[model samples]
Target: MPDADSNPGNGDGREADVVPGNQGGRASRAAALSVRSLAVRSLAVRSLATLRAAVDRIIPADSWPAGWEGGVAEYLTVDPISADRDLAWAWPELISLAGRLDDEAHRAGADGFASLDPAAQDRILAVVAAGSGARSFDALRRVCWEGYYASSEGRHPAGLDMVGFRGVPEGVTPIEPEPLKTVAPAVVQAHYDAVIVGSGPGGGVAAQVLTAAGKHVLVVERAPYLRNDQIRGDHLHGKRNAVYWPTVGPGPGHPRVAQLPDGDRVLDGTDDASVYGLNADAVGGGTRIWQGMAWRFMPEDFSMRTLYGNPDGASLADWPVSYEEMEPYYTKAEWQLGVAGEEGGLTRRMPRSAGYPMPAMGTEPSRELLGAAADRLGWGWGPIPLAINSVPWDGRAACVRCAQCIGNTCPVNAKNGSQSTFLPRAIATGLCDLLPDAEVIEVRDGTGSAGVTIMADASTSPVELTVSADVVVVSAGAVETARLLLASGLGNDHVGRYLHDHRTATVLGESEHPVKPYIGPGHSVATLDHVHADTIPWGGGVIVDLMGLLPLTSAGQPAPGVPGWGAGHKEWMRGERANLFGVFAMGQEIPLPTSRVTLAAVKDRWGRPGAALRKDVHWTSQQVEDGMAVQGARWLDAAGITDIRRQGGPATASAAGEHSCGTARMGTSPENSATDPFGRVWGTSRVVACDSSLHPTNGSVNPTLTIVANAFRVAEHLVAEWPR
Candidate 1:
């Protein structure tokens, strides 16, 4: 048997206890043994009974197997959630909730919650929802759904069938021909021409550029290299699932302190989406599991300050490089990464030198409905540019249009990320070595002796090593890159300032037609009309026809005041949830100097100070979101979709940090920015930042394409300036 350290499912590295036909008898026997052994290590009898009852109530057996019978209870008792390291703080509350359920049941004159009639149990649950136990109730409902929806690998297979979800396309699996070649810590060289601190879009592009130039490169990534098999498309537990914790992460030992106005709360990367600001930490970083929307910034986006002056307390600045300058690089990135999209009909006008390498993905049904609505509204709309293959491109297969995308890895190796493209190309040259599961704690800055202090196997038995490099590039995302510079005692006072991200609002409505949303990438057509609408406050954003409505994602918005559990909620899931469509608007937030990352007093397992965040999204960003929400609702109404509901906006400012950037912003001077125009850290010539951290202002669209383009530009510049 494999050791627990090697496991992805339950920590024993064994295949999970899936249902018949999915696994062999040995795995089935192990699951059976695990279920039987729960009495010793699982919840007490009363608590287990209460939990089982709760699960049944959340997802009742109307036309399908109930949550209680469909492996939910067993899933809760086993490896992933039960002994999850990151979710350790949540278990006590779950235990308490079980005990509280019985107390409530007794008040209602029942022997126990599980012993009460279904209707009676629901009445008590309603009382709990209205009372202080509301939070606990929500938690229970969430865990129940996660257990049911995320564990459908044979364990609740019927639930997926009922929802019209076809599993991974036939014969689809992880596409890497052999295991990814990685350099063991013992074999790593003490010196390199270039050492990149991340393996994300930026770092990957940099590696490809430098290695192709015959420069020896070391790519250090803190997270483990997640094989496709390891990234099981668990709806609630995968890398993209922000409901609890992202599977790929800043991990257990590396916690951040959110300095909220209420108080300083220590947070895991998954604690609060708005405040924690988590990007993936693995080999491809966010690219491995991203939705692959490759959007180009409008020309005006580069001149944010020139278009609309800064809002009060905002650090809005124009990028040192313009779209005209970056256009060639953008084209290069699009072609290299294999984007699929149609040209023209952009909402906000952007002059493109060339079209996408591949044609747009076949329009999803939701986009057709919304595109007609946009035509009626006289808004320019076109297919969303995506870094995913339409046909077999660059040796990768085309997307199978699986219901699961965004958070899940591409089973067919169609989703083009740094993992699939740049990194592999760099590795093929044998000039670039990737060091996964290694954390660069600090960069030693000097005139000619640039190097980094690395912690190998950071999550386990860590060993410190010092390695020298002629050039050092940091691409560890916005917050992490800023934190790294601060931790390394590098950069100026502006090192972690001007932090911001895209604030978004999603307007959901019941489509008049059956726009099968659970197919393909979440969004298809996006309009640029909102990108620079004068009617919008501060600035405008883009609106996309969004899809991918999983059971848990649907549960996030219950029908207004209706109880989260019981027959009414279940009915909502079956009817309204099934016919749902979404219009999502993402707005670029105003960067505030006050919104910064600093070194916190709290230390990690490695005894390093944690990143402290004081995230402040300006009111204008909220107004931008609100304006977009109004437009989205208008579009939905025009599309004849009724029962409109708005889920996000500036009100969700705390969680508005997704697509986060602009921490170590770029500028002309060291006094105002962490890095110069060429991505060189102001104070140090050898150290450079190659990620979105150098973004002076974030665009209204996704940043991956731009990050890749900019990294390519910067890497090319570095090679030209190399001491040849």
Candidate 2:
């Protein structure tokens, strides 16, 4: 029998109890009891020997499976293990280590790894498991863990329900109405019951609901649409066109700055036109570029004061409402967004009201191996709840299982983004009008009141328009929305303050087996072990699959000490692409008054004041690094991998720092937060800022679902307060 140490618990930290050989036992018990006992014991011993032999044939016995696929052995077959130079360089070393283990075991009169004493087995594993040499055992471990938990077989052992998923609240149907025909261009200026700025989650949902409520709505987007066949059927190009891409070097267009080591700052403000990461400027905003991993912040997340109380140097405060208050809205977002997956698992956080709209996406084979390893480690694993349709739902088709879903738009409409789901339905109701490529430069104060001034290209000629209404909604995302408010001087002092982003760190490795990485959603699984304060004691973090790599992005941004190009580089790329797997440790960045967005002296193509984003994240760096290391290690152990490589610490820039928030926070007092609980701008009656800018803190999860839910809450308030 395998020793207790060898038999680790599942990812959720539960003992693994595999049913004793029942392949044909129940039917043939009577005939084979006596003879079967002896044969079965012999077979068990032999099978154990074979497993050991296999382990010894490729790599060190101590180096167990680190990811979903089990180990480096399994990964090499399915993915590109030799692509990464470091991984390839370590291949021979791993083989040699395996041979040494086999020799050592044979000298001890053991046929294979299983025959060796448990202590000896552990000793042998210790050597290669240290992963001190050329290859990154840490990276391998992460891939194996991710691959295993993401597979069907692995999901089963982890107690993940692959088939059934209870989704959002019932009785909440899409408010679909009739479509309004486009008005004649020359007709008197068309009137609308409401005009929504920005076509992201909040704006999209608002448009759909208001139009369904029999009100005429106009949806305005600053970026041009990139759907259909205009861009070679690749959604990435569309995303690039819509998102604000920053330059690589210091340039006139660069609006952000990063402080580096040696006390010198590496100003990203280079003249190079190559774009870096930022929020999407298209109709769908960040949703078009997001990986679609949806998760609800724990009940405790909203009430930080009630849970851990306030901490110094942070703006931690309890939300105006509790989880129960937003519970119904959460369900509404789930159903409307068409998320797919199971609920009610021991490892998950949120409660479910009904099953998912469709089945879960297919699991990768690598996940199977990692699941087994996790079971041995006594950790719990669960199906990843995602905002993606696994089957046809509400006129949209199912996902095609592409590996490029990360940092790129879905070629098919399977991914439930605002553009594909809410906006279309809202447009179908003749009550809504979509004005693409219309940039609102300022929110013109309507003679001591609130209104907006918008600029757009009418037939490629600059056209300016003024809109006056009883209510004005601002949903221009965190950075842009804050800039717009500041530019218009609506609330300049509060507009660009308290900017925050989820600080991110990464771990990468090469596994033993092939993990077909590009087949499913970029992130099909995650671990929330440290997502709450109880786990980290000081701060919290969330773990998700690493974003897929584009060749240029990967080569250009190699990990420290990794060669960029050459024989070594080519080898590294080959292995890294196939066998490599990564993990992103995302932690909530505390809201700091110093970290802010400001208008630069420069101007954009539209002659608007260019927004300069300044981030000083040193305050929360220590907490983020510590939390990530802990959770990352746990995942590695669960995947049964010993070798590992990690990058990101206090010194590293927060990963992308793209999910920026808190520029216009929400609170009861205008002195602290920028808006009220109902998203109403303080000191104003009919002006509301309904976007991520209202987030008090960038909670340790994706902010989309929360943004949408809060928007619903705000809409309800607006309707209630509407002039009778």
Against the true structure, whose lDDT is highest? 1
User: Residue by residue across 1-724, what tens digits does model 2's lDDT show?
Assistant: 0000010111121111111222110213333343333433543534524333433322232223212223323333232211121122223343444455555567768876556765676565555455452133323332222222222111221101111111111232222222223332232144455667898888988877777777676677766554422221121122321111111111122243232233422222211111223455556766765667666767767776566555666656667777888888888887888777666432356665556655666676555644455456554554566788788787765666655454445556566778777788888887777776566777653433455666654324546766665566788888777778777777636677877777666666656654534455655555666767465644577765554443323433455455432234434444554555556677766666767777766665456676665656544545776678666666765665445667534433332244667777788777767778877776666667888888877677778888888888787677677532
Provide the TM-score for each candidate, comma-separated. Answer: 0.89, 0.68
Instruction: Please write out the lDDT profile of model 1 over residues 458-568, one tens digit for every residue.
Output: 655678889999999999988889889999898899998987777778787777667865677667788888777775765688888766666555655565665566667
Off by over 4 Å in 1: 1-54, 78-117, 127-139, 152-158, 170-177, 269-274, 561-563, 654-658
> What number of clashing residue pairs does each candidate have, in the order they appear?
4, 101
For model 2, what is the alpha-carbon lDDT of residue 222?
Answer: 66
Name the 10 consecutive residues with the lowest summed lDDT in model 1.
1-10
| Residue 519 lDDT, candidate 2, scale 0-100 | 57
Model 2 vs. true fold: TM? 0.68
Against the hidden true structure, what lDDT does model 2 obtain? 0.54
